[model samples]
Target: MGSLHPAEKPKAIDLSHHLNNLSRSRHPSPLKDILKYMVQPGMISLAGGLPHPSLFPFESLHTRAYAPDSNLAPGETKHGVVDIHIPQTSASTSNIAIALQYGPGTGCSPNLVSFLREFTARVMQPAYADYEILIHSGNTDGWNKIVNLLCEFGDYILVEAHTYPSAQALWAPMGCKGAPIAMDGDGLLVEDLRRVLANWETDHPGVRRPKLLYVVPVGQNPTGSTMTFERKQAVYALCVEYDIIICEDDPYYFLQLPAYAPPASRKQESQQDEQALLASLVPSFLNLDYQGRVIRLETFSKTLGPGNRLGYFVCNPIFAERLLRATEVTTQTPSGWSQAILAELLSAWGQSGYLTWLRNLRDSYAIRRDWMCDLLAERFDLENSPVPTEGVLAFAKGHGSRADRKQLFSFVQPKAGMFLWLKLNLIGNPEYERLRAAAGPNVEAQWNEAFWMQMIEAKVLLTPGSYYTPWEGRDPSPNRRKEEGVTYFRLTFAFESHEEMRLGIDRMARTFELSWNLVA
Candidate 1:
């Protein structure tokens, strides 16, 4: 065949319009609201789950960072290599160059695990000492990898009744199921977990147990519920008894109440007080892991900044190898720049200083926590009021039906993390169409999609409740059979300022009033 001439070459076909459909599957843009309301300005937005940049030690990092200690001979440099513990406001100019380079797939070039190791030792001790560690892009990445490693298509995983939405979303596409065990305000109900597991076993004898048990054992997302030490012990015992792996996804482990903050910098502070500081802090599941079964996921998204997209997991060497293999195939690793910056920050912070920083973060979040809770309590007539709140998020129940949720969706003002989880009352008939209309396009295709659509169309976005089900491929087990009982939505508060949070709440209240007025 003769070669075609330049003029004869077919004009390049454009598929921009056709490609628009793909955007539906993509993540909600952080800047979506900004784009939507570009012309009309608004107040501080609690709509995003974001960390305050003002709180970050930007000045400190700009001033005191050390030179590339990786290049220095161990004993040769007393002048350039800054010890990880001593806080620095800036680094040598060369340190900036080091951060700009591409990082290894595993994480920071110098490795933050050293500090993590020391911190793990001082706090976690003998149990976690022997466990292996692997760094990743973020907690979500780590969580996906853990599920990928442990679960085959259609396998089941366990979660709390109301839990983190992103994690639930991650499992949905893989044909995996989430069997939501009931939860109390404190977190996953241990007795419920025990009963559910026993029931599953009784029902399906020889088949595999759940691929993993996922829980945010500390300062849980949405609910901002922290697991008590007693609860932790009970849950841990169940995992041990069940021979199931526990994926401990605690991004809010450090954002506890102000009472947990370490001692202030003062000349006369005693050693005894330091010991007390360490003892009083809430313990993590990894801290109590007698076996390597507990996989601890750590993230810089909360304390550092969500934009950083940095997180790590500590567990058995075997699991680490599997996670790394999965990382190679899936995400290929987190952002190189993010990994480097995080490593540099952690390497400079060391164990004690890092703990001190975490305590400070907890104290900062506590103020926001109280402010948000007080606002909600004064305004919303929730079915069940909260106990004195501690963490960054809170859960509330409003009097409304699934239809009311569509109109009144946006009223929640969260105090912590990036969102709030709302459980609404479903009225009258239970049919998929009503949920489908409330949900959007996917209403008929995937049950969750409908719920998502309903909320999205209302100018508020939320993850659907169905994504948490443990129903598997073509054959969803009878125990995990899908039903139309969901009456909930998640809203984020971390992104907005106090003013924005209040505004979002006020707007939501109006939305509810309008919705209820129509229903009446």
Candidate 2:
């Protein structure tokens, strides 16, 4: 597909018309008007029922350096740690006074907010002129806020066929329905999106057309598929054509891994070449969004740590201001202590230093990815090379000979993020075929349950593909169940140690071998 020109970009959706009743009724907090002055040089604020900073007992706060030189691996340079101390004084910017006291509902400390704005401007270079930023707790909170802000009850949310389960769980409870868009190896398939939107009324008779699209464009949660630049352009074009709002929840944007290299070949590549590869990452949706329709959710969860609960949203001022209003009534703000600590850390690191830290983080995860991939390759009978096929498991299912039944498993070695999405060869399982033949109402669930049980018995656990399946209650056919039958398991190499990763794969391979009766 050709690149979309400024004139060619779709018209922006009117966000005001899409907002729910509660969101539409929401007005700015009166206390926020007064709280804005609390930071002024001589302002004595008795507004907002804020707690007195003097009443707090603690005089200071301290913490050890996070990841000091002592913790560095051999030959690795030390990324400076964040040793912090916040005095009780109100005079100092890095003090506990403002942090301990009630502040703006926007979750982030003023300094942290400034830092993130600069960071976003420098890195993302969003094309929209009216874009604004709002701090939130994390992507999870961000997703919920967006759902509440945009979706009315019974509204359809378009998502990649394989998507973040937690996001679905949040939307499902709100009476929102998921409309699953088909995906290729690159993530959400544009053609499927076009087809679904074009035929919405006929295919989904009486159901509302989806106005919102939720996607994890970088290292998509369970699938670990990164949308290519061309694919993203096509997707954006479709979203414009369909008049859909895009919610880009990308927590793993910076954790993108370098292109995979075989174990033997990696040793041959020079360090310069590897660094060059790392620098060439795919552009974010925010970068490509010309119309102010894309709202991006970014987080420090994957990079800094989830415990911080710090993230922010980037969107046009219209949506951002509304999201801030949502925050005022809900979380009120993210933990002040987290924002304060992160502010100090970011100020110390600066932009270049921060980029270095991200590089170190990406390199570390890449090592883990390589370790896990190598173990899976050794333990499972698999195809190492990418096969030319459409959708997941195209290579194995399409080209395999009758004798190739012994090749029982395949995976798209992730180019980014922590997950390796394993497509199990359930077609070779005698029980699976039997269950398919019977085709009872609960047969698909039973097959998945049995398969899950076997894996648990083997002492390895993985997220079932069904958890990521979009629930379309309106569909009358049995095709959804059949689609769920294409067995997939998401494995993460993030938390596990090198040895533990090896052990997990060993157990997974043993379970597959036993189930398929392919033991040598």
Candidate 3:
């Protein structure tokens, strides 16, 4: 991959005004700042407390890494395995000695740091000339640093109506609230964002509009929506108009799969060259960002392993400096072991090999996604939605007559990420319909809980919708409140085997059939 940036590009717009007091007050750690001096040749320094690689207890670390093009399926390691050794001595550039030693928050190993920079520049291709990268201990740490850097107590921030719960939880203690914008299958609506920001005082009296926007554009957490290039352009334009900073937490960016094709319509998957693969995908917010207002939080968690706990930020230098200070006090960097291992593997594979691996992983997950959708089709009378949203499913099996058939649940077969966001149709279920009519308020919550408990009793586990649903009293839609009347579940095809997926889906289908009084 080559740079999408031109020879001359604009520098980032000064977004310093948006920073809170804490970020403005941040100063580089004096001891950490001295690190630039240690890297010089023949510099015999005893300035900061540092460990010698020879004295380190660990000698050699032997690791068998799956090759870049591994099948990534269960028991598919036979595809290829690359041997890696992290030597204790400083013989190699990214040896264990230096990795295991205390290092800067920016990164542990220069080799890994260099690798990421090239990866971001070549793959992510940020539009600006001066975009900088800062490594951290994955998206959680990355977001935490940003939260501390940008958020003052009692500030509001824009989030998807259905957003990541943990992120919202992280800022709540500081009195920051979520100003959730409406979303459809595509993602958070651009108009909704404009409406919120443009009419802040009128719509939300006693409080000002938010200055920060947190979004998971690719494979959004609960909704599994991926914003198209035009959609992102619109969203970015709105952010620019409103002077808002966009925080892109896209862990599943590489897990991007193709649109759903029924088996009959399926086409053979082809290997994509690096450039072709790059062209096929939607560019990141960073790529569209000329002003460097987008703070992209990317992670190896989705592609490699979550245990790696390695992620990085692509943002302007101003924000990077403040985030570095936050990291000094909290999670400094990813584990040295993680850095060394990743560096060795990445160095061996190189950029092209890694992209091949990502494509393979994407294809494998797509097959798993198809499998889950197939199971859903087998277990119920899954049909085209009446509304006819592409890639969406509606399932219902009436007792006998076709007229009795009603949509019990539906989901947009996600083009990215692992989870299927199943939207329940409570009005379609006869039992639920009768209850909704007879029972007064909160009936949906009670019934949904009871059904979820039944699924639990039947040995099926799923995350409840309420967990991802943003806190109430903020959304300005009456129809949006209708989401409350329905139940939802996030089913994953990432970890489980095909057999396990079958069993789980079987249990779920049976549970739905029995609970909804539908015929098999």
Output the number of the TM-score-best candidate: 3
* Highest lDDT against the true fold, candidate: 3
Instruction: Give candidate 3's total backbone clashes.
Output: 0
TM-score of 1: 0.64
Tens digit per residue, CA lDDT, model 3, 178-280 = 8888887788989888877887887667976788999999888988888988999999998888889999999999988898888889998778899988887
- Which tens-of-lDDT digit does each residue in 119-222 have in candidate 2? 87667767665577788898898999999898988788898888888888887777777888877667888888888899889877897888899999888889
Give candidate 3 regions above 4 Å deviation. 1-6, 73-77, 390-393, 398-401, 428-431, 472-484
How do the residues 1-520 of candidate 1 rate in per-residue lDDT, one tens digit apiece? 0123324323212212211122223333334334234324655555544344344443323334444222222123434535332122224322323333233345434456666666665655425334666778788888877766676665678887666668877877877767777665577888888888888868667765684888886656665556887888898888878777888887877665533221242132222234665676567776556566778888888877778887778877656655655564456546655655656566665666566556555544654554555556444543223333312222223543233333222222332243455554333224444655576544334544544564455565445544443334555456652334335555554455677667656555444444334323
Clash numbers, per candidate: 28, 1, 0
Evaluated at residue 507, the lDDT of candidate 1 is: 56
TM-score of each: 0.64, 0.89, 0.94
